[model samples]
Target: MKYNFDEINNRLGTYCTQWDYIEDRFGEKDLLPFSISDTDFKIPKPISKTIQKVSQSELYGYTRWNHEDFKGSIAQFYKRRHDCEMNLDWIVYSPSVMYSVSLLIRLLSKPKDKVVTLNPMYDSFFTVIQDNDRQLESHYLQAQNGTYEINFSLLEKQLKDATIFLLCSPHNPTGRIWTYEEMEKIISICKKYGVKIISDEIHMDIKLKENKHIPLLSFLDIYDELYTASSCSKTFNVPGLIGSYAILPNSQVKDEFLHMTRKVDFLNSPSIFGMYATMVGYTECDDYIDQMNDYIRKNMEYVQQFLFENLPDFHFSMPDGTYLGWIDARNVPFTSEQIQDAFVHVGKVAIMKGETYGKAGEKYLRLNCGCPKAKLEDGLQRMKKAMDWLYNNQKGGGPKE
Candidate 1:
């Protein structure tokens, strides 16, 4: 293979949240950090070159949003990749997905209004709701048949009085790429309750398999009250650029959101460099992305096999999309803190504590599998060894299923 994913790319001193802050975050410098979602790989050549070209320019003044920058590349990407048609007028710029969510929440709902979301979801949804002085109601995703499923009956009940719903497509941590049928049911319930949907699809392009991404907007007509927040950051490993777009089709919804943003002057002009990089990523980096997907899939498969063969105490399903793997460690004899400690102190590996997502995530951990194959293998070996020692050295007894 011409591409090299074997070498250990140094990220420790790069001010990377995944690496540089591990000591401060976990209170140990030796933690083999895997908590953050950023990838360890270097940026693609095309994107790098574009950024370099933009850097060479001397002037850094107030910039304007070009129609070409906002539309053509993304519109083509969605239409070709997901079969969803988008118009230029439907797009709005935001610095990040979280910002868009917060703005939309402030626009669509008033203080004390209820917003609904699935438990074991991205934590930002909860923050956005609280930051805007709104009430948040969570319906936990049922773990049945070894996969997470939305309990439509419970969801319908929750949506009855909710004013807004936050949907995480190809959901974070769990990696369940929502099917069209499930989405339709959600839409039907929301429509019944007059609830507007804010779907965060930031991880839509990082599929590890043949399952195609379906934009929730595609299920409804142009007049549907759906807003999509997405970015090339996750897909292209450019989160540092701080560029994202929100897709709102309903004119009233779009206008209201814009009005909210204007109050704070949230007109974030994407850096010319970031714009160039995004265009190159969407238009020219297909093969590179395919290679990345293949690598992540293989790493996930390796983790799955190791867990099945060596450590049967834990339960996890391989992610269908995104580089995050959600593992259930409840059957192991450790508290969430203990599990986190064991991984960092004993195993010299670090992973996200699932409790960060919500209460239902207490005994679970989210591991990022976007690193090199060798790094993943090393981390898994450390984890397996730690688990074995913990179980064998147990004084009382192991946990029950």
Candidate 2:
């Protein structure tokens, strides 16, 4: 079926965190926003149909997520897409991927134990670790030729006594998918240090061009203490449905994890909508995913071209995966604070600052190219307008602060 990715849907007044609630993050309103991770695209019809069907029934009730329809569908997806064999029993549902990570941080490590992950990671990784009283350790990734490489020497140092090696596959902010050999090296290091692996593969399905996402599960033979937290929400743009799962390999730990979900977290049952959404997403939405990715890659190319042609000071390289464009504006001759302020106050636009991810991201900004082409163009125009004004300011002949 042909998907209408060009169709623009008005998200204003929807109480969405990406559009309606930017005041809390950007400290302003009525701006064209590319801040939040979720996209503006509509959910796939198959998933939405099930959502509507459940809504019309007026029979919303506790739904079990351990059924074959849920786990079997997920297992089938991995086997079909990535050639990864997953045992249905290893799947355990959670409210969301980050929630699963939070639960696992507590499950695997004690308070103040170090958890090492890449620098400039998803902002929540910083919070989830600190919030759980786990010491957060940073290992900076080396970016070369528009792609990022993990610094194994420093990573191994940080992993010495670290309890958890929290990894972001098809990483956020910068969309480089780790290759199989790199994954093997990471697994080897973790094995040497006895660091429990918790990989967040939430963006696993957003493969751009020919890049393939190798699941952390692929390293099972090399390391058995691996736990991967992922969800169909990112793939199907249904994060609001609030459901995710963790692939736990160890039987004892998996049982304990399920027990915690049922007994302590009190998520004994999952959201009916979330359960159906996952099942349909994994089964019926493969074609939709392919088309959406094509649209996203086109948008990414457009962003790169726009920045090169119009905003020459800013640089963007087509990422290996994900719908976000990481714009490097280090040569723009302005601090991220100045640029961000100009974007909101002068240009009336909101894009996430690089610093929000980590200190290393201070000269960069993340743009969400996940919306319709028209919306993305408008956003880029607003951003360019802001940058133009900043450039003019240095000449002492533009809009003042």
lDDT of 1: 0.82
Inter-residue clash pairs, candidate 1: none
Q: Pick the candidate with the highest lDDT.
A: 2
Local error of candidate 2 at residue 36 (angstroms): 0.5
lDDT of 2: 0.88
TM-score of 2: 0.97
Q: Lowest summed-lDDT stretch of 10 residues in model 2?
A: 392-401
lDDT of 1 by residue, 98-213 (tens): 88988888888899999999899897777888888999999899887667899999999999999999999979978888887888889989988899999999999889766677
- Whole-model Cα lDDT per candidate? 0.82, 0.88
Q: Residue 58 of model 1: what lDDT?
A: 77
Instruction: Report residue 110 deviation for candidate 1 (angstroms).
Output: 0.5
Q: Write the per-residue lDDT of candidate 2 for residues 199-305, one digit (tens) a residue.
A: 99989988885679999998798889899999998888888888999999899888888889888878758888888999999999999999999999999999989
